[model samples]
Target: MSTTSTPDNLELATTAREMADQAPAGSLEKAVAGSVAITCATTRTYQEAIDVLGGIQPVEVRRPAIEFLERLAVAAR
Candidate 1:
């Protein structure tokens, strides 16, 4: 399979990287953002990536990340 770095995709990738970088060190948000960044770089969906990393638990703790991932997933398409 081949991947082209379209402007939109590149921006998304950069956004994901920034999100991961801005997140607190060793925080769940950081981990999730990092995982999502990897997923965004590939052909996989955010849900698939999140699930594999163990879906955000308690909901409240990861509410922000969840919302962000949802937006990213939509944008990814």
Candidate 2:
């Protein structure tokens, strides 16, 4: 976690983990990413990320997607 996260991120991360855990089996990563995105967008319902973002492809893009999810999840609080 970064300086911006602190305790809020912890709580949010836990919630996110629960959300992710409840997601459908094969789409864990997408569900998590969508949860983060929905939280950041302050949407009442969580929607899966439509793009094929969670795939393990090039490193540069993958890392950023993870980072963006974390940042968004924290901001969701």
Candidate 3:
């Protein structure tokens, strides 16, 4: 895990947390948001989240999740 907490990182983490909180429990969206929240809140690089998200089966979930993860990856840098 990295400790590089930039403004972008903080914002992304906040967004992830919000998404996790808003998504229905046991939903794929919730799972994705939770993974992203964990990654960002812990100040970890986004690759782990990316890898986990890649396994998402539903196109509806995977599409937006990947988009969010990409933004997170950029912010994590």
The numbered model that scores best in lDDT is 3
Candidate 3: clashing pairs of residues: none
Best by TM-score: 3
Candidate 2: list runs displaced more than 4 Å. Answer: 5-7, 28-71
What C-alpha lDDT values do all the predictions have? 0.58, 0.48, 0.66
* Candidate 1 structure lDDT: 0.58
- What are the per-residue Cα lDDT tens digits for candidate 1 across 36-63? 5665566344444445434445464455
Off by over 4 Å in 3: 1-7, 44-66, 71-77
> Which 10 consecutive positions of candidate 2 have the poorest summed lDDT?
43-52
List, residue by residue over 1-77, the lDDT tens digit for candidate 3: 34343344456678888889999999887877776666556554455555666666666676677677676656546
**Candidate 3: Cα lDDT at 6:** 34
The TM-score obtained by model 1 is 0.50
* CA error at residue 39 for candidate 1, angstroms: 0.6
